[model samples]
Target chain A: MVIFGIDLVLLISALMISATPVLLAAIGEAVVEKSGVLNLGVEGMMITGAVIGFIFAVNTQTPIYGFICAAIAGALLSVMFAVLTQYIMSNQVATGLGLTMVGLGLSALIGKPYEGIKSPTLSKIEIPILSDIPVLGPMIFSHDAIVYFSVILVATVAFVISKTRIGLVLRAVGENQEAAHALGYKVVRIRFLAIMFGGATAGIGGAYISLARVPQWTEGMTAGAGWIALALVVFASWKPWRVLLGAYLFGGITVLQLNLQAIGVAIPVEILSMSPYLVTIVVLVGISLFGHHTAPGSLARPFHASQ
Target chain B: MKFKSVLSGVLLAFGFGTVAFAADVKVGFVYVGPVGDYGWTYEHNEGRLAVEEHFGDRVETIYQESVAYGADAERVINTMAMQGADLIFTTSFGYMDPTISAAKKFPNVKFEHATGFKLADNVSTYSGRFYEGRAIQGHIAGKMTKTNKIGYIGSYPIPEVVRGINSAYLHAKKVNPDVEFNIIWIYTWFDPAKEADAAKALIDQGADVILQHTDSTAPQAAAQQAGNVISFGQASDMADYKPFPRVSSIIDDWAPYYIARTQAVLDGTWESTATWDGIGPGMVSIGEITDAVPADVKAEALAMRDAIANGTYHPFTGPIKKQDGSDWLAAGETADDGTLLGMKFYVEGLTGKVPE
Candidate 1:
């Protein structure tokens, strides 16, 4: 019974750890899509952040600076997307895809030397009074600052989107960019900021993997987490809290399957290993059938003043 | 006037008499992962460094790490060829097709693909018998484990990884008849986060010993964090962690092979062929056995290594049974390359199926 209890706690902790990157990326993406821009280059941005963060952290032996550098790298890469799509009037989808490709190539080139070397891990923040609580202490309070930051970000984003005027304008741009443009709202600028914000968050997400989760950079380490975040934006119906719930839900599935295999569950390892993705797809299809009413009016479409 | 023209012509001929030598031999390396990964790529880079160190003036080495084994690989190879590389080494199994195609495109350049079988006249294949190292580690794990449950973190379901798991399990079972091997396929060669998660999961399930075919120190770190789990280094010597983790390691010594191959090219005797070296050729080396191991266990492991090296014993000798208890190898028979290369299932002692 004691072993089972420990296993359960470990599994939950694993879920939280796995969900941190996705949550950070998805929430930022939520804000981006909320502001009327769909950046398909989240994966690319995350990978770029991963390599840059790894290089910075490895060189300086400071994980905090690594994260900051990662955010900046992600933001810089996003600016390229912003310039092409917002300024030059290129197709947003094409620009975003191009950004991913460029980011992938650039990260590959830059990360060449830093591969395989472990980085300094982020220090954990043990919540003082709450950490002493029996089951939740180690699982929740004993996590690194990133986990708590993600939770706070989710709450802040949820509150901002539902209750604030700036979020109202962002939503207005997403709902009807032409109308927002007519109102002197500067739709392109708002969307650009949204995209940059998303990029920055995705950067943190990527760094979370490199600096905290894995604490090392490997080629293609993001491993479709960016895509999962993209899916999550839709799955959450563009709501912040839902995004958090969805990320953790998916994270739980991922952790559970591995734990199930570990506990010698009477199932094929391959099937268990694949179950998380399968479950995500199934839930996605189910949600699609049920109709996600909160989807952005101009989700994937590029918004142009002339259009 | 005729004398003046003769003098001018002789002066012009003297100016044109100076000649220049050919450029240095350019060698390019395409790695599947980063050079610092402390595993497969790290070992390969060590070999690259060795080549540079030996033929500093005669060779110019250039490498691009983390080249994926698909269209990107073809592009990188083409780029290297265009850059005037005389030899290219694509160091991954997935690079087999791309390497072959690139070799055909650049006939002047020699190509080497690690752990791949298909080769053209301009292309060669090379890999160390890593299973031998795994077998030795397995022997130690079997003898040392308080719980007879061994966990294997496999990178992929490919034959190379399968061979390692099977060989390790075979040796472990030989030592501890009650040993049960559990495998978790992480489906990637280099995701430390997933690798750590896998390690933790294994430890949680009462596996005191862990082995991995993936690259990175995450598994070792994970074992250390777990506070009692033991693990072996994947590709390079990781004994720095010592008694806590990195109880033993399978060091990939590609430097000698790389040096020899490059030297052959310089000497103009390079040829396309397949080379698979084992313990005998020093390709597979064991790291310093930790003091955590029982003295007797360490001695036994060394004895096994010597036997494997000296041809006195074969790890995969006959009288083995398939998982279904069918005869895999008859008595006095060793496993043939044909069987070993395509091995997918565990032997009779193993309980689980090789998931499709």
Candidate 2:
């Protein structure tokens, strides 16, 4: 069925695929920021994950194993950021930037051998009856496992952050690290774990591009996706559900702009290409003016055990 | 006595290293996209490999991939020159200014910029006439398109890309009068997700044939996933999707040019020149026309390829009109190199203005 000269089913399917990577990265970053640590090396960890995941998937001939290694690779790179920021008390922003550069270089080196090589693709899951439905069925019920996992991840994160006792401690550390430490909470340990979680998710996000989206390893394939994911965290205002909404919104605009051109809209193509970034800036400004900011209190601040 | 002997050996090794470095010609490449793109940059890197294979111990080649094209390109080119690279290939249109500027600074090093028009004493520009291949693709697309609607995913609105669009449209229109061209410029050289999304959008809008200037296999993948769509490869032969969506390709065969230029550098005969060769010079070769196309259409396409190669046919043969109804080329008149080199206006019948 075509609506406004666009196939509704195909548009939604493409939207989900395009948004999944950013959504995963943003949600992971949201969790990291909520734990009083701001790891700005999502791009670095993601590229690292992309290369490592691609290599493993190619060698093992298993897409799932590749994802596991990608997550591990991301976490391992974050450990470097964690050590510098948490243990050595380095500046989070500078160190995170360094990590990103390092990740880009490292991934390029590792991915050199795997260039132009295709990886094992993940097969889409189609529900026998549901997938046969008119419009909504193909769009919603039929997708690869990762798509469903992303939605489930959002819900799981929302529940944990709002209701669970562990979530309270994590939020407490972010709100007031010193106070949380005085109250006998293991602030450093909790923050370390949160950073690792962020790294793992970002890794999976990167891997998604290589293993599913493009299904091939290319040097710098993540492009600026890590940076986009980083921006998405702020756009979400530290909420998991909002991250999904923002990612899909960006994806929708990206897809819609192309559709507009396909339907022969006379607007210049440059303007259409710039629409997503322009909308992002406008939305960010709108959020600042109307939406209440929910940033962690100790967002970029270093925590010290002594005084 | 033993220590003195060891010191003499070390001095001998150091002397040999300097001699080897001075003797071997070092060639450097700066790529706008990654070598893994399997498209434009990948083909250039293959040329680089060809240089290494041809000269063996006489030459050394190194490349920096995924380099951004503006100030960063200037820095990378300068570094290559400073590091004693005798010849450097700045492979992208956006690297034109940087290549020229770097050429001014490093007079001794020869630089070649691809798909650009600027040239200096130390910097030569070279590009393939890809429009010739595009014309063949247009023929096949026009003949085989079930919807008579062809969707194009353009990278940027540069003259080179604009030229390809016009050539394809002209040929498509010749075969099928009802053929309509829908162009979507995503403004990126390589972004699989964006390319795929663009392909999907075009398919959704009743475009059964897809053509792309962007460097990725994603569009072919998208077309294959959608089923029954016809597409052609750009820059390189995407053989992985052969016989179906990717019916054929416009291959940029830079190996011969790269080798010839490198040989000239070795011979000290290299000079600044603007080379815009097409099939006649063998710079652009049409890839295999697969079985996906009908036999009659494939034969016609191959004949067109041979005619273009043998100089019997020019893709931009005249009697053309601009989009504004102005005369671009009169009857039996061909487009001059100068106008084609800096093409800005669209030919008659194509919709929309060229983006500034």
Candidate 3:
């Protein structure tokens, strides 16, 4: 029984660690969606960041700089989708999907020489006395800087969206781009900036996986984490705090399922293994039932000047 | 006018006197997973490195990782041929048909598909008999498990994975008839999170011993976290987490085959042929048994290993029965390559069907 208690604590810690990547990705995606540009290629962006980050970290022996490079790479890749959907007036969903395929192929090509090599890992940041506080310290405060950054990002995004003028303008653009444009706002510019911001965050999130979480880059390491982030945007009802909540909830489910198995609970392994996906589906269904808010009015709908 | 005629004469002479560039031997590799996966593909890449190191000046190698098994494989191989690949190695069972089709298209190029039996004159096959190692691990699992129920985390329901599960089960049941095997097909080869979940699920089902064919450290980590549970490393020397696993492992050593094949290419003796080596040829190696295993069990495992190496004892010998109580092999008759290659069902003790 005592072992089970310890297992729960360890499970929670694992959940927090797993949640960092998703939180980083979801937050970046939230900002993108909030600015009225739908980049469904978050998975592609993340994987691109993962390979580039891994290669750079391996070559430079500095994981931090690798993350920076990853962010830049992600933003650059996002530019293709930005150009296609924004300038070329292509369908957002199709363009994003195409971007994903391109990102996957390009990463596979560039990542050839880097196969099987381990990259530098990010160092954990312990908050001195806070890290010594029994189970809570190791579970929360003892994570790497990126994990802390994700938490801070949640607070900062919430604050920015609720309190700042830029937030209002961004919201205005998302809600009704034509109205925002009519009101002397540069709607396209705002959305582009927001899209870049999302790309940068997604890149960092990917770097976190390669540099910290798994601490190695494998093909498709993101493994649909980007899709999860996309789902999280809807799960959170397009709200910042809710996105954090949703990411943690999913993260917790993932960790808890593993923990339950670790503790030697008497259940069918297949059932236990399938629980996380089941929980995700159930939560999504529950959210859809109760949370009835529509998506951003300008979401996925390109705003051409002619229109 | 004389200067123009002289220039023209010089251009014509130079054109006629042009020297031909020597063509490099073009080698291509198709990987099932990203090369960065520190297991199967990683080992294969190491072999590629060995090839490069041996014939650096004469051979040029190009490879694509994370290639799928279907139509995409055909496209990648065609693309490589178009790009001037003379010999291509498609390293996955699913790559069999694609390699065959591509071989037909590119008759000038040699194609080697791993773990597959389908052959064209230009398309050959190669794989290690990993079931030998699993037999030893199954013996250990039979000895070590406090609970008679053992869990297996399988990748895809292919013959390769099926062979491992059957071998492990056969050995386990030989030691302890009460042993029951439960399998969880994760349907993926390298998702750590999924693998971890699968390991955990096995533990939840009261399985004190676990074995996996997936490519990741997640299973080992999950087994470690489970404290009393034990597991063997898949596709690599994962003895790093020893004592907990404690007994045996099946390590894939692709370096020798890769080096030999590349040397053959460099020496102009390279031929398309199926190559499958077991423990005898050093293709399959067992990691050091940890101190945690009981001495008697260790001795038994070593004896079995020696028997396998010396070919005195066959792991899949006669008198084995299928799940339906049908005799799989007659007494004193070793299971032949045809039966083993097409093995699709479990021997009586397993509790699950081969997932379709």
Q: What would the per-residue lDDT of candidate 1 be over residues B1-356, giving only the tens digit for each residue?
A: 99999999997777664213333688899998766667888899999999999988688899997777689999999999999898899898889899999999999899999988897999999998898888899899999888988888887777788889888988998889998887787777776678877887788788999898888777887787667889998899865467666788899999999998888888888999999889999998988888888899999999999999998888889889988989989898898887777788788877666777
What RMSD value applies to candidate 1?
6.2
Could you tally the backbone clashes for each prediction?
2, 0, 1
The candidate with the higher DockQ, 1 or 3, is 1
Whole-model lDDT per candidate = 0.85, 0.89, 0.81
Cα distance off (Å), candidate 2, residue A145: 2.6
Candidate 3 CAPRI classification by DockQ = incorrect
DockQ of 2: 0.56
True contacts kept of each: 0.33, 0.64, 0.16
**Which sections of candidate 3 miss by over 4 Å?**
A1-24, A44-168, A175-178, A186-220, A231-307, B1-23, B147-149, B225-228, B239-248, B263-272
DockQ of each: 0.30, 0.56, 0.20
Model 1 clashing residue pairs (backbone)? A115-B37, A116-B37
Better of 1 and 2 by DockQ: 2
Once fitted onto the true fold, the runs of candidate 1 whose alpha carbons sit more than 4 angstroms away are A1-6, A44-142, A216-224, A235-237, A293-307, B1-26, B57-62, B70-86, B101-109, B239-243, B266-268, B330-332
TM-score of each: 0.84, 0.91, 0.73
TM-score of chain A, model number 1:
0.94
| Interface RMSD after interface superposition, each candidate | 3.1, 2.2, 5.6
